[model samples]
Target: MCSSVNAELLVDKQTFTSQNFKTFNGNNIKEVNVGWESYGNLNPQKDNVILITHYFTGNSHAAGKYDVADASLGYWDAIIGPGKAIDTNRFFVISVDSLANLGVGDPHVITTGPASINPDTQKPYGLDFPVVTIRDFVNVQKLVLESLGIQKLYAVVGPSMGSMQAIDWAAAYPSKVERMMSVIGAGQSDPWTTALLEHWATPIKLDRNWNDGDYYAGSAPIDGLTASLMLITQNALSADFFNQLGKQTVPFQALESEPLHDIRKSHSIVNWLRSRAQARATTMDANHLLYLVRACQLFITGHQHDFSKAIASITAKTLFLPATQDQLLMPYHAKQTHQALIDSGKKSQIKMLEGPLGHLEGVTGISQHTDAIRAFLKQ
Candidate 1:
């Protein structure tokens, strides 16, 4: 039962342009306006801010309640409340929407990306929008912070894609954040992860309806999107979960009894796959997804191209919490980040949570980590 506040609008809600908005590969410049939401009071000192970044489909809603009045409460309602991990009572939380979000469905969400208004023909930019990087996402965040009169952050936090943004914040503006936590995420995207992500994009690309990503009026690649999500869930879950929950000894008759597509659709594929895919498809811009994937592929921590250097550059008190059973981003990635920070002479903590639920444990069921996050935020 998270509630909403009627505070004066913080961001002016307009388009922004920047010549320095370069792509991850340093290819070209772009303009961006990162949409966001803020909660709690920004004390006169302006140091009591807590930044919350969202995952792939997550938006400005991070806590108590505030996306659409009819929609369910914030995705992390259990952890973000008056006295929960985020503690709205003590900290003002600010969550941001990434560039090229399709959530704001008006005008077809032509954001700065491979799809945006050309400004020349007044038509959809369609591939004209410059590519955006994670660093670019952080830059827009800086703009929002500056505009709102916030000079520093008490902490920056999130899980999954949000975690990447959190890490970038600490690395890019070490002086601004005092603490940073990344859950179920890695400092850099590994090839295995990238390969899987490419698969996710494949269905969309191969579908005839994709139409070179210019399919505005024609049918969308819903089937391909659905199939890709089905694959994603299988890869993301842990063996323990299936062993416990799946039919261990289905009758030979049952195997023959169940319809093929029905069986496929029934394997939590509804809750786990369809829900996530539809959630992502509705809000994420097709081209923006490409931009984000490329940005993830470009993730490096240090020495211009080394992840270790990127990890070493982080000066904020770091906490890397990855689930022990996570298959997508695996626990080893968290351990790797933690070890890198420690080896860099930074006192970072690496604690793993044991869960049968793999990567999803960081989201759908995150109570244990919520407690850990509470303790961290308190400090």
Candidate 2:
């Protein structure tokens, strides 16, 4: 089925700007802009629309080739094409770059974050930018859709943090969102998950070069940013997968990287992770990562403090797809949320992705459950 997915679905980034947008916290941003991408066609009734919110590190490119020869495809290419689970041929698939998206340095990504110029001061917002929330993200997206005269959504789907947004949608807008597929999702950020998210912000703050998120004009916290990225990558991966890769670096092969050889030296695995992070960081901003972390840490379904009351607003037929070996969010995270939905008398289903890849399995091994997803969408 994956092989049957066409790689020819090319797309371009478009910008949406909402003026004097007031955040949920009562903070007003002069202008908020974000990039979005869409595939397939929107029917005249405007009812066949599916919004795919992206994961932590992902952008608006959910399923398409920016360029045909580009080596990488959109993150969910396998299930989003002509005859795939999402089947673009029959549905309009759209994805938007999140507020304070990490990919600020990427040419295709347009986001309003710490690095964007503050119109009032003629300089980058830096730390002056107001803190944002998951609610703000959904509101901005609502503005974008409203701009296109689109009302009501066929479904909202996402993975990880995106799943958080999807659930938020069904809760905050019960009458609008018809279906929701939350992959690696939870109903709320528990104390443990909240604490883990704090760790991601800590690394960026500890970097001496961070300057309290004012490093835009300076050297930038490359070290701290890379470390933060590495932390997220490790947390998202399974121990067995890391161990398998770590074994490739034997004692002798790690000689130069051995601390015995030099205090700065480290293992090949460490270097490999750092290198991978460095590549991603080139197009990422540290402040944006911090802001995004806080957004995630503050998230709860419907943005309500009461758990039971929060999910009470959901009217969508929901599906919870958790990675079987996920070490970061863990299967139990999804389980608790799924049980809550059932207890609340909401339509909900749970399915586990079986694989050794852990959190990554939801993306890499998703095709294995195509029938399940396809049927869920059909219903």
**Predictions in order: lDDT:** 0.67, 0.88
Q: What TM-score would candidate 2 get against the native?
A: 0.96
All predictions: root-mean-square deviation over Cα?
A: 4.5, 2.6
Give per-residue CA lDDT, model 2, range 130-211, as digits (tens): 9999888999989988888888999999999899899999988889999999998777888999999899989889999999
Question: What is the C-alpha lDDT profile of model 1 across 122-237, one tens digit per residue?
Answer: 66665666666677677777777887788888998878777888888888888888999888878877888788678766776788877777765567666665656566666667
Candidate 1 vs. true structure, TM-score:
0.83
- How far out, in Å, is residue 26 in model 2? 0.8
Q: How well does candidate 1 score on lDDT at residue 69?
A: 48
**TM-score of each candidate?**
0.83, 0.96
**Superposed Cα deviation of residue 232, candidate 2 (Å):** 0.7
The lDDT, on a scale of 0 to 1, for candidate 2 is 0.88
**Model 1 spans with C-alpha error above 4 angstroms:** 1-31, 67-71, 102-115, 239-254, 258-284
Best by lDDT: 2
Over 4 Å off in model 2, which ranges?
1-7, 248-257
